[model samples]
Target: MKSKTVLITGGSSGIGKAIGIYLTTKGYNVYGTTRNIAKYPNFNDFKLVQMDVRNAQSIKDCIDEVLTNEVRLDVVINNAGVGITGPLEETPSEEIVNAFDTNFSGPLNVIKAVLPIMRKQQKGLIINITSIAGYMGLPYRGIYSATKGALEIITESLRMETKSFGINITCLAPGDFATNIASGRYHAPVIKNSPYEKVYGDTLKAIDKDVDNGGNPIQVAKKVHGIIEAKNPKIHYKVGTFFQKFSIILKRVLPDNWYEKLLMNYSSK
Candidate 1:
């Protein structure tokens, strides 16, 4: 059997990289994308192609390049996204737009590019990497949460729409995992006298700490591989510590104000 081809966006580091390396070990043809191919001088895990998820043309070029050599694209993992944290009022509008573009629309772009090809072949798989935070709005990370939440909903719709074409789509919402996401995250400056300064500032530190102490990303990779091999994938999947995953269930069962209070108390901790 010919090896199945897989494409992952923002694959140079973090979860994307972990997924790429693991899939490669499984003998899948993996191509990871980075906006700047020159950045990784020593990357040899799989294959790194040039792509900026924000740009449609770049995504197309990357997909084209992959198909040019391999002739078949089987799986696409939309994993490229940015983290944005700040009080929603303080975050620049442009920055909010950028976050949406990268986190939500970026995945949509990849799906658009791959759908035609996948439909032509009459079979394909797309796994959208979302965040558990997206299940609810957090204190300082509202923008990031909104972005991921949007993608999560869209995934549900896309899955049903594309199922007839033999295209499978599912979203995986991960809780915090140890990666460099905190470093690349855009932080709106904490104005000295702003009303939310102390609270937002404190919450920001806790956010980074949560990511720093999170679980190994390879666990996410393993989940992805299992999804790939499944005969019928579910619409939603999440990988995280017991507490993190439980938080979603808590939100579902708790009353509105009660859940808000719970989140407030958790953020304050």
Candidate 2:
């Protein structure tokens, strides 16, 4: 296969960074974007640029920079996102908006910016890094699920619409990995005397523990490379452990009440 140019957002750390490095090793020219370059600077072996997916101008600027030298963008990984945990009632409006803006609209901005180029070139791949939470609503992480589920629907539509143009769009829904996502997660007011304190504390601790024991970030990167090389990749890729991916099927097959109970039990444990 010919060499390709790849652009990955939020590539400074975690899965994005891992994908960039893995792709570079395979001979693809890679440009990884991050808002904070100083902290990451360079991650092993990918070129770094400053780009915030939530900002249209920043997205345009980064794509323009990549196009300048690379001539064409062969792949785009929409990996920039944020995590928020709070009861829907207590989660601030601003926090909700920010979650949607960063996790959902951010990918839309990048996709819109790059679509023209890819359509003209007649071939490209767009991967939106979503999460398994998107498949179902988890209590405190409802907003996060909404954002990812929204992206999945959008990506499905895009795949159908862009089929003839050779633009391949896929959603990479990962379960959990030991990334810094937990450290920087958004929090709603879980102050003393709040009714949700005990539950919130318990759920958050459980979530973090699951992530700590989750698969390595590099595993996702390897799957990304497979998606890149496949002539006909699927519309969605699940990068997680056996049971986590299986839960998607379980959700569809199980009775509604049963599934809800499962989520209640699983998330709170």
Candidate 3:
């Protein structure tokens, strides 16, 4: 069997890095992108590229580099993203815009850059790393959820559009996972004399606590491997602990008022 080549964004750490390491062991030629490549110690059998997803030129250059070096691309995983956590009112406009650029626009740029190559090959896979927040709304995570929500729609459209070309698009919607993403969250600057200061402050604290108890990133990576290698991949894969599954199911079955009350109560304490 011929080896498959995969290009992964944000491959230096977290789920992306875990997937990259696993795929390499599975005999895949993996090329991953990272802004700071030197941070990751030399890992065996994985190639690293310096690319920023927020920059269109960087994304195009990264894809071009992959084409020039590998000659063929079998898979493209859009996993590079950032988290901005705060209530909509408290979150600054600039913060929201940056979040959208990194989470939504960045993926679009990467996908656009890679599609031409994938179209020519007529056979390829695109896996997008979304969050459960994409499906269920969280109290203080409006901006983050909006970005994931956009990704969900884009994935659906791409799936339908590329059906004739034999290209598969799958969105991996993992619940909270223990990753640097939580600690690395960018908070909107707090106003010194704002009425919502206490509320926003409390929300941030709750978010941090939830993230601390999230599931392991390695588990999510294993699920990603399965998704990529599966003969017929599902459009959405929800991988998380029992609570995550329960919450998503609840959101679907429960009434709006009941769900809102439950979420508010849960987050309040």
Candidate 4:
């Protein structure tokens, strides 16, 4: 009879914001965290916490505030991330570290902070927003894909570990949802001075074009709503346009050499 409480990271914009709005409208109490809550004044229905996932102290403070106020967390959505585009050889070490910290460790930190409360309650859901890139490698997205891939593995392990605790873990693997995530792509500062700059310059431009043509974020949010409301959420859910479904099938059915060529051909365009 009680309304469920959902906590989302990076909920100010894009997929996170869409999901927050949808779930809030559905009568779930929602809390969202962002580095700049002032920038997102439209989130009047949900509590906004100023927290940066890369900082341990900030995460602790944010979680503590939520626990103090809400007392119990019914769901935790790990959606905070960044995009890095460039050849691995041309990418700087700092950029790679930042990408991993935000996309991978950010979710781990949030889950760790929320698990105790969920354990106490004896029932909860953890949803990880990963990407189709998690399942397969892609050109110019080496670091980004690595982060999502790591998350997919972690989600699977957590699902198995938490089954007995009445906590559910689901990894939502969406393929190319239209979001500002594309605009957040960071070009390594070292690339400007690196010898392989020319090799990745054109590839980065192509990546931007691909993102611009990606599907809608609202659709992905709808999928998130369905997953959360379902009596039994699947281990992995993929949502996107027809192309995404096709890609998922290809990745599973096609041979490795053929899949590599297919991805390379798609990326080159």
Best by TM-score: 1
Report the CA-based lDDT of candidate 2 relative to the real structure.
0.90
How many backbone clashes does every candidate have? 0, 0, 0, 0
lDDT, model 3: 0.85
How many steric overlaps does candidate 3 have? 0
Candidate 2 clash pair list: none
For model 2, how does the per-residue alpha-carbon lDDT over 199-223 read when each residue is reduced to its tens digit?
Answer: 9888988888987887889899999
**Comparison by TM-score, 1 against 2, better one:** 1
lDDT digits (tens) for residues 201-237 of candidate 4: 7677776776787877888778888888889888988
Ranking by TM-score: 1, 2, 3, 4
Q: After superposition, which runs of candidate 3 have C-alpha atoms over 4 Å from their true positions?
A: 38-45, 189-193
Candidate 1, residues 1-269, lDDT tens digits: the string is: 99999999999999999999999999999999998999898999999999998999998899989998997899999999999999988999999999999999999989999999999999999999999999999999899999999999999999999999999999999999999999899999999999999999899889989999999999999999999999999999999999989999999899999999999999988
Better of 2 and 3 by TM-score: 2
Q: List the candidate numbers ranked by lDDT, top first.
A: 1, 2, 3, 4
Candidate 4: list runs displaced more than 4 Å: 38-45, 189-199
Error of 3 at 84 (Å): 0.4
Global lDDT of each model? Answer: 0.95, 0.90, 0.85, 0.85
